[model samples]
Target: MKPETPFYITTPIYYPNAEPHLGHAYTTVFADILARYHRLIGDDTFYLTGTDEHGLKLQRAAEAKGVTPKEFVDSMVAIYRNFWGLLNISYNRFVRTTDEDHIKVVKYAAEVMYRKGLIYKGNYSGWYCVDCEKFYSASEYLMIDGRPHCPIHRKPLEWTEESTYYFRLSEFREYLLNLLKNKDIVYPKHFRQEVINKIVGQELLDISIARPKERVWWGIELPFDKNYTVYVWFDALLNYLTGINYLSDKERFRRYWSSTHHVIGKDILWFHTAVWFAMLKALDIDPPKKVLVHSFIINKGLKMGKSSGNAVRIEDLLGRYLSSDGVRYLIARIFNLGKDVEVSTSLLDSIYNSELADNLGNLIRRVGVLIKKKLKGTLSSESIDNTLTDKADTAVHKFNKLLGEEYEISTALQEVMGLLKEANAYINSVRPWELSDPSKELYTLMEVVKVAINLLYPVIPESVSKVAESFSIQLGNPLDISVDVGKEYVVKEAPILFKKVR
Candidate 1:
């Protein structure tokens, strides 16, 4: 929590075969909000997001387009980076599984595991879905009318027999179970329970960690076998650490990895929780501090349901709102922790209209407009009345109290919104517009309104900064986590924070 201590977090490096979507925007926004909030509270946070370019999925997509895998991944990655950049998502590092440093670290992790006898030769024969990018155990694969179907794609999985190197995952059952019991290995508590109740609840299978070096040559080549490439997960999984590997960059890796957290999807819980921990322990490194698994975004109020043709795309949301924060705010507000949220344009519109426009935005406009009219464009640092202030006096307190312990962004925003709502109602009842008089009593009442605007600085900052400047009050002074409201405050000028959405 200290500024000097690193708070390292990462999104699951995305597969680059498809264009980015709402699902991609969901977790990145979640992490970005946390990053922005923590930095505001003085935490030294580092957030990493990027594409996982090398996989059989990308390889096949490239072939279908008649382009080399490199060409396909190169162009696709550009689109992903540009999309995130457009949304103002500030990622500290954009990791690629195909990067030279990552390739070496993956090989290093494999070699260490292999040298420690955690690796062994094996033959894998199963229904493998290239599109799904995962091998299904018979229990998981749906036998549709007789053929194996991908649980995700709901299509048949290709059967394959390959000379592969397997990680003896089944042997780590009790080890992983104890780690789960320990609870710090993964987090958001409920998702960890899901991992225990579901996949890890089933018998752990020895995972195929390498493919025939020739067939799936898109991944890190195994150090122990020139004939095989390390499996996507076996290497791809280590990126959380490779960005700060002990053997490679001991001090930096140790500092960062010791406090790492992974924000991942619920579907991939098995790899992050069970397999990832097993690999790190074999290498004598500690597992990540926590793994936060969030469920996917659903359409039409159910997470997995699809519409007739199109699903909710982040692109569409951005096109409509011209702001990613609206999308981020909806995702944060609507979903309970680790649960899927169905997003519709209607849901997006409702939040934007109700929360941002009406509550937050209208409060600023009503207050700023009245101050300008009454005070004659001169910002007031004069004391205001407590009649209007008393109604919402607890809001600033509630925001700091809730977020002081841990950054609950939505909850804090809600508290701030609650106060804004109260201030708007108070202004309506007191008729601060009619309170524009020369009396000392009337001047005191206007000061209370200015204090309320000062309280709103955290959530909708830009407008409030204008409010601060209009009165010539110092904005940054009260922005600190330990901020306190001054007795006298004034609005310098009115600047519009929210333009009415067409």
Candidate 2:
């Protein structure tokens, strides 16, 4: 990828009916890491994340709270913004479905679809999951204790019938099947297979695109019909287009939309790959360049939920760690890209102590102390060590390859830590403390540390910044493994990067 090339990516807009949890933070943080990596390598990157505020669920929850839906969403959105700030999420834009610009684009898309004969007047009768704000047929819901309940939420399903506008989703059945056949539509082949089975197994029915305005008054009103409101899902999906100002700014939209990626959870694969892609085809627009589907973060073999008392709050986890970077480090280290990960406080503590505090932190502090004491806090430039150079090159190459191809974040971090362990072993073998003049050996050690920090800057921004400051090097240098060996380096007094937890 060239520096001038553009890269656009997004995390699905969270449904803010409740507080943010580990699942929400997980996806957003992963997107941020990729965006940062693109920027570090000099790409024009745009990263977006936000909340979904308007839906039947939001209206019902707001009524129960004795406040209007807008007021309720306003308070809930603040919570999401605060948590993302605490975790240092680097998103270029925070888009909400209710924003004026976003609303305009969504309405524009609905109107365009209606004009293309892709949407038509229809009636719908089925089981509706109010919690998910989605409609399900009989086969989609599960039977529980003689009554039908939503498979996703495990709550009683509501039987409802209404006059609705329907999108001709079935018309795109073959279109979607052919689209999914392309490997770039969804990664990790297995997930793509799941999508294919879903479309093939179930009869592809035309989906409802509007709800009677008298019943759900909080959503965007349909431009063609005064008595109905655009379906929340229709409005929500347009957010991807909103990132480039699809309705108002044409040139900008073309620039970014040409190559776009979506980071989503496994649960929403059908929504993104099937429905979202179908809508794009109806509009005669190209589908997103790719979709990166990831698994959930669970506890005790169950998905994290507030009612289950297993959901871990971002604030609670951050408070337990020495720095926010510690929390970020552990999550990225333990996260399995395509499988669910079980998280516990004990697991977090153990990983932090062993890899971060013992291996990585110990290396930085030891090297910094040696130079400050023996070499008078000054480093003389020396040719890069061949052995260490090979190790650094291999780590950087592996990191880039994994992130670019497999999206294997945890595995990438393991490779970087492997390089750090090698550096630590070199220190013990050379025993630089015994050398009256250890400038050359110390220089190599510092170079290794510098390379490690640069590679990790995307994952742990705060801690890496502190490391660069201690060595008096400019942060955000172009991505590379080579250090500036000709320039004299100065070491400064700084606090320990990671403190060992008891």
| List of clashing residue pairs for candidate 2 | none
The residue-by-residue lDDT of candidate 1 on 291-341, one tens digit each, is: 877777666552222333445565666666656555566666664445566
TM-score of 1: 0.85
- lDDT for 396 in candidate 2 is 80
TM-scores for all candidates? 0.85, 0.93
Where model 1 places Cα greater than 4 Å from the true spot, the runs are: 1-3, 128-160, 198-200, 245-248, 301-310, 381-397, 400-408, 437-492, 500-502
Clashing residue pair totals per candidate (backbone < 3 A): 13, 0
Per residue, candidate 2 scores C-alpha lDDT tens digits across 284-357 of: 88889889888877666433223337777777677667577887888788766578887766787888887888
- List the lowest-lDDT window of 10 residues for candidate 1: 476-485
Per-residue lDDT for 151 in model 2? Answer: 96
